[model samples]
Target: MIWNEHIECMDREQIEKLQSQRLCEMVERVYYNVPFYRKKMQVLGLEIGDIKGIEDLHKLPFTTKDDLRENYPFGMFAVPMSQVVRVHASSGTTGLPTVVGYTRNDLSNWSEIVARALYGAGVSKEDRIQNSYGYGLFTGGLGLHGGAEKVGATILPLSGGNTRKQIQSLVDFEPTAISCTPSYLLYLAETLKEEELLDKIKLRVAILGAEPWTENMRKEIEKQLNIKAIDIYGLSEIMGPGVSFECINQCGSHIAEDHFIPEIIDPKTLKPLPRGSEGELVFTTITKEALPLFRYRTKDLSSLIYETCECGRTSVRMTKITGRTDDMLIIRGVNVFPSQIESALLEIGETQPHYMIYVDRVNNLDTLEVWVEVDEKFFSDEIKQLEALTRKITKQIVNIIGISVKVKLVEPKTILRSEGKAKRVVDRRHI
Candidate 1:
């Protein structure tokens, strides 16, 4: 089921060699065409000739989201405006949205890589894909749409929201595959159960991404939907949702090394870590034309697995993302991540996957509260049973994160559901 087997299964030595060649050319392009990159290289005393291969990647200046923001729209584009064919942007919730462009070839390459991702997820031309990711400026929807088209699979670009229509299409279209955020999938599962349409649809494989989720969450989705849930990783700053994907083996996601180079570095020291060391994930676009970023810090935390996969792809695999350095929450002098809270909740097996973390300052002291959605069966339990459940969750959080958290066991559907990426954290302290 491997797509583009030649590139996916290329020898490790050959892959590195190809990456070196592409990296050298990309560095040259950015150095000459983009003034921003030229100034960066000059400031670092770096020259195009000095960047000979992948080994010199560390010597180049790192590109951060701030760099993209400073450039704003079209400033970071290496190619002329006439050559650019498409544009996409980040949500820019904190500030100005980071903009990205794509040439005809860049779009084509994106499709090919996305196709590779679908192939890795065991999707093929025979499968009908239901893409629930939102379409407009967000990259997830169109990104998966184009890739599914490239794979010759029939696609129903349902976009996002409209739960009634989504369920109707799932049953009417009878799509064999689905793609969307994991949280959205949970909402869809809930709707399906409400309407008793779970058995009416024929979804076999799910490509979930755009948010960090735990293994317990994945198992829950699979169990509820009766399908295999595969993780697909990407960001708008990079190429979107197909930068890497998990194969059927589910060991780790195989990175598309021929196009982008992956690296893990200590967030504070900014020094590259050895293979299998968990740290910040960084990327360098080797073949990108419109926007070629060098050592772009993704801010995601994950390790790399270089051993050959049983699935037979030599490309390096990235372990499931644990959390983001930027997403880390510091409360009462304790660092915590929403994913940690999620893992603890799902492990207990009594609560649903939907939960929210609220951090606030009370009496000049930081306080953490977790709102968990209890399973329907537990909602009718005795008051003492609910109290005991709350105590159990509080103990688990204390044991795992070393911080006492107030656990509120809310009834099912109490917490709002998201059709796009789930909003799991609300830190009122920032406000």
Candidate 2:
């Protein structure tokens, strides 16, 4: 089932050797071709020869989103415009989107990794992949598209939205697999349920990412969709939706270590941490041509597994991302991630999966409220019964995050659903 056994099943020592060689070449590429990185190396008194291998990776400068934005549209591109083949960017909700470029070689490499991801997750030439990820500026749609094409599977380029059309295509094509955000798939599953068409279509595997999801959520998704849900990891900065993926074993996502060296680091100190330690994830692209990055801090929180997988891959795997440091909310001196709240809610199993967190400062103090949707059967219960369920949810969340949150129980299907990344948090506090 391995798409490229040569790289995926390589020995750990051999993988490290290859990474070192690629890292050195990548440093030289960035040092001379991009002045932004050259200035960073010079500031650290680093020369091209100083970086001999991946062992010297810690000695180099780290790249951040600000650095990418500071470079603006094309400042970070290592290759000239004539050589650049394509561009993809972030949503830029806060500022200018971090623009990523690709040469012909880079695009080919991107598609190769994505194809490996799809094939690793049980996709094959015999399968039909209905790509639900949006196409254009974003990387998810096209990233999976190329991967599906490389798999030689029939492609249904049904971009994000249009639930009716997605379900219709599902029924007509009987695609064996799908690719999209996990939250969107959940919404799609609900739609299928409403139409009583769950069993009519044939969907065996799901490739999901672009947002942090808990193990409980994954189980719920699999249960609801009647398909094996696999977690796929990638970011626009790190080559999009195929940076790594879970195999049939589903222990963790196997990283493409040969192309991008992965590291777990203490987010606070910006220092590398030991394997199995939960910390911020960082990556260094060694084979990228258009936009090569050195030690780019991803700000995602996860642990690394270095052992060989049952699927026979020696490449290191990263546990599912717990949360993003950037998405963390600090309330009354306590930091809380929405994923933690989500995990707590799902474990309770009393409320529906749909919920929202509202944070606001009132009367010189910060207030947190959780709007939980009561299960359909419980929504019409007596006030006392509803109050009891509310208390139960409140206690579970308080116990997990050490914060007192007012739990408000609402009716099922009351919360708005999204076909893209779910909007789980609404922070009204102005800081």
Candidate 3:
């Protein structure tokens, strides 16, 4: 099936008209088939007719992760189990994993959206993609796998882990693109550098996702790995990593608005913010059938712009995520977010990506500690060199986080292993 290039290049008025039409159809379908939407509409004294267009979307109640949790398992599913061809769940970080189901049609639509995202990222049939995102239960691996297949790219389904083995596969398969967490890509670069085989690997593009990273880190990864680093944004609840992706311009990720509607709202007030205003990102799935979400608050903080992209895609664009509202760690009455520390760490230019923020209370005072993993070149048996490095990192952390931190320089592999999202904060404080 061919995508509408015209829709992708549509002007503001044209995109809005198309979105309004899709939103109206989505509302009607959900109201009729999904119990959750019916209940929400009834409580809001809303009828299907009331939601005439996209403007009336504000009249509908917003959905959230908590709401998905409240109706655990298949409560939010619009279709029966027999119709659901696939099921995936969140990581259950907050509570029980919220399950999402997809019908065959939904699966097909998902593939199409993902394919468009890849195309927007400059991936084509000639490209070879090595999908390092973990497969099974997790949607990133399979979601992108299907998209790669749809685009007719040779897919190397090397789903995460075994650094040496991954490198071997790259050596043999010679994939042009890779997709995984940015930190893991750095891990691969480190492994390649250790084996002195960095020059042997051939990769043109990288699609990094599932965590918030800075532009500085992007340049660092690109420089070390010798590939164009791009950010792909999505959550399992919102239909995996292909929801949006960065184009060659790298300004912001372009949302597949034809399938999913994007909105930026004030995190606290839940009011929609104007374009270019930074706020929490929200999504409303317009094409999903089994579990169509309406105004689902993603809680991720970022800005959105509707201007035409240099890549010629008319989809609304979102800036790189600054920090998640939930991921913000309150340390010593000062708000500390991982992205801030990430930016600071990248600015330092000496430390690697493997660093942990340790927060503990000492004598009724908050004590912050940063544990940074030392590279092989920096590893020293001499105590003076180690102490100097530690002191330098400690002072930098204090300057950035506004709290003096004890910097612990650990061995190369002393830090904890992160199979999924990297753990940023290790807080023992009881709040």
Candidate 4:
């Protein structure tokens, strides 16, 4: 799988024809191998031949998280359990995790896609990659590790946590690149600063993903660590972290068009949205054997572009996810994302980076509050000054989120620091 030479550099017409051919085969394979899909097809009165190509893809029923949950462990799997070499699961905060399986060929295919992403980002066989993404049920660690190895990269498989150990590995290994969540990398940068080992380690690129991050955050990390921070995007349901990645251009992440077909649709109506339109990302796995999902609604909000990228790849480009449709919060009829609050908080230079959002219902009305940690160096004993600082943050939040929020300024380290997905929202009303 030398990166599928013809597919990578194909013209628009050629790519479309290849995708159409692959889609028809995948749909037929799913109908025969997976009972869940067969039942869905039966109810819809659809047959294998009906879906002759990509155009018929829109006719197929969309798969969702509920479908995966309904099937539980193996009902949706296209291959037998004995053939499955690995299984990865979702975080499962809501209920039972959505599980995904992979055969040996599937794993190899995944590695190839991931390698393409790495190669596009300038990672070559000679480089050493330090992987800080967690290993296990989560796909980040192993997904990236396998790809780095496929590219002949010497990998330092240092999973997340243990800040001291992570920094030690960085110094000892002196890897040329690193992969992990953006927030965790920021935390690592802070730790490295405290240890005064920033200059000793050598890293040119940092592949960050798994959560939504902004260009502002990217600039901050780049400045702190002195590395070119590149954005890599993927979901566990799709194929881990190599579904798409930003090439050298840094404009947007290029989706692996040949393997996973990308489509944008309105989350509410499920109607197809036009290209370059921001909507929920839906994917149809074209060549996947173990689990070929047809039109799986990812709920991730992004836009799609199908033009030649500056990086010279014909693969489609997807904008960085601003926020997930499911994660949106309704506060007094105003829709908001935690990232909006974070962006507002960052603008206020007075407060520290540590902050938490709280929502409560009082007399059937929602109330918003933010707890912002104050740096010890900027701490003042006067209550009036602290109140003034809080007022400034409150105004900033109001301007950004269009909702007035009470800001509480506390001492340093008052709020906990999370290395994984940051717990920014506390909805007492939901409880």
Q: What is the TM-score of each candidate against the true structure?
A: 0.78, 0.78, 0.76, 0.77
Q: Write the per-residue lDDT of candidate 1 for residues 7-38, one digit (tens) a residue.
A: 99999899999999999999889999889989
Q: Highest lDDT: give the candidate number.
A: 1
Give lDDT tens digits, candidate 3, residues 95-209: 3556888899888877877787777667889999999987877788898898888888899999866677789988778888998777678778877788898778789989888
Backbone clash pairs for candidate 4 read none
lDDT of 1: 0.86
The CA lDDT of each predicted structure is 0.86, 0.85, 0.79, 0.82
Lowest summed lDDT window (length 10), candidate 3? 328-337
Those runs of model 1 whose alpha carbons end farther than 4 Å from true positions after fitting are 328-431
Question: Where is model 2 more than 4 Å wrong at Cα?
Answer: 328-431
> What TM-score quantifies how close candidate 1 is to the native fold?
0.78
Error of 1 at 217 (Å): 0.8
Question: In candidate 2, which residue pairs clash?
Answer: none
Ten consecutive residues with minimal summed lDDT in candidate 1? 89-98
Where does model 3 exceed 4 Å of error?
Answer: 1-4, 328-431
RMSD of 1: 12.1
